[model samples]
Target: METASAESVRKHVRVYVTVFVALMALTLITVTISTLHLQPAAAIIVALCIAALKASLVAAYFMHLISEKKLIYAALTLTVVLFLVLMVLPVSHFADRGL
Candidate 1:
């Protein structure tokens, strides 16, 4: 039992370290993207995509959401849907104004 527990802890630690490394790599990519001087719209899109991935990593492992129940996933889906709607609202409004 102790061996099993120790193995589980090591596995969890490994996952955490991997996630940390991935997050750091993503941060570096973000910095590199910024230096590319992309157009504002393209840069925003790229940045948002990277940000979403980073957020997912944090939510899944750091927040222990990967092992959560269906109800939790449903709620998270709802939140994402609402967030996307909120994000689009401004863009749509600007489009309507010909901006």
Candidate 2:
């Protein structure tokens, strides 16, 4: 029993280490992208996409949201939907104004 528990812990640790490395690599990629002279809108979109991925990784592994209940997932989905709506409203407003 103790051996099984220990192995489980080791597996979790390995997963966490892997996630940490991936987050670091993504950060490096973000920095490299910043130096590539991308257009302002393109750069913003790319950076936001990368940031969202990193946030998802952290939420899933570090926050243990992956094994959470369906209710939790539903709430998270709602939050994301509202966030997207809030983000788009300003952009839509600016577009309407020809900005």
Candidate 3:
């Protein structure tokens, strides 16, 4: 494997630190929102959105996915799509049962 240049290493470190800080800020926001007495559905939605953002940052920076090949990206996209479909299936079933 090619050795990374010092500048490149420094850039990666900076990016990692920035992502860490953002994750931390999102965590604080999550806690803050909990105390704000938002409606149950709204709170769940906001928390899930923040969690998704944090997950994205973790995947991109910590997992080194930001620089991955196209094949990896395509696989990741497929995984996300399948995950969403799985998640929605149960909800769709409940909705159909209610009708």
Candidate 4:
């Protein structure tokens, strides 16, 4: 029983390590993207996409959301939806400026 528990812990640790590496890679990519002189809209889109990916990874691995119950998943989904709605609303404000 102890060995099985240890194996499960090791699996979790491996997942954490993998996500950490991916987070690092995403950070590097974001940095590189920022150094480029992209159009403001494009840059914002890229940065937001990278941030979303990092958030997803952290939520899944570090927060153990992937293994959580359906109720938790539903809450997370609702949070993401709310966040998207809040973020996208600002784009309309920009659109009014003819950008």
Candidate 5:
């Protein structure tokens, strides 16, 4: 039993360290992308993609969402859907501006 506990701790520490390293690497990649001076749209897209990935890592590991229950997933899904709707509304309205 004692060995099991120690092993669990070691595994958790390794996961945490890996997450930290990944987050740092993503941050460095973002900085590198900015310094590369890519076209505005491409840069924006790349940055947003990286930001989303980083956010997911933080949410999954740090927030303990990876082992979350179904209710949490349902709520997060609803939130994301609502957010997308909100984002699309402005774009759709803009498309009708010239009508």
Candidate 6:
């Protein structure tokens, strides 16, 4: 088993604190945006964008995925690509409709 030094521990703590602060800020911003009287479509898109960003932050930091191996990163990338494809499929319903 390898042992890390005090400095390394402190660094990890600092990163964790930063991540926490960022997550809190994102949460606050999302809440504030939701309260605004945006058009339905715009509000939905904006909320989805914020949700995606928050998910990324949680996955990267809270999940410790930022320190993961290359294979994990590849998997994460693929997952995001698939997610995007799925997200766009619902838009086809609006294509034939008159705005």
Cα RMSD for candidates in order: 3.5, 3.5, 1.8, 3.6, 3.7, 3.2
lDDT of 4 by residue, 1-99 (tens): 124487798888988888999999999999998999799999999999999999989987788777788898898789989999998999989999999
Name the lDDT value of residue 11 in candidate 3: 89
Off by over 4 Å in 5: 1-9
lDDT of each: 0.90, 0.91, 0.90, 0.88, 0.89, 0.81
List runs of model 4 lying over 4 Å from the truth.
1-4, 88-99
By descending lDDT, how would the candidates be arranged? 2, 1, 3, 5, 4, 6
In terms of lDDT, the best-performing candidate is 2
Candidate 6: list runs displaced more than 4 Å. Answer: 1-6, 93-99
Task: Please write out the lDDT profile of model 1 over residues 1-99, one tens digit for every residue.
Answer: 124477777887899999999999999999999999999999999999999999999988888787777898899899999999998999999999999
Task: Estimate candidate 6's alpha-carbon lDDT, on a 0 to 1 scale.
Answer: 0.81
The estimated TM-scores of all candidates read 0.81, 0.83, 0.88, 0.77, 0.84, 0.70
Model 6, 18-73: lDDT tens digits are 88898789889879988997899999998889888888887877677767878988
Write candidate 3's Cα lDDT for 8-87 as tens digits. 98889998888989999999999998999899999999999999999999988888887888898999899999999999
lDDT (Cα, tens digit) per residue for candidate 2, span 26-61: 999999999998999999999999999999999999
Total backbone collisions for each predicted model: 0, 0, 0, 0, 0, 0
Residue 6 in candidate 4, Cα distance off native in Å: 2.2
Question: Model 3's lDDT to the true fold?
Answer: 0.90
Inter-residue clash pairs, candidate 2: none
Task: Give candidate 3's error at residue 3 in angstroms.
Answer: 6.2
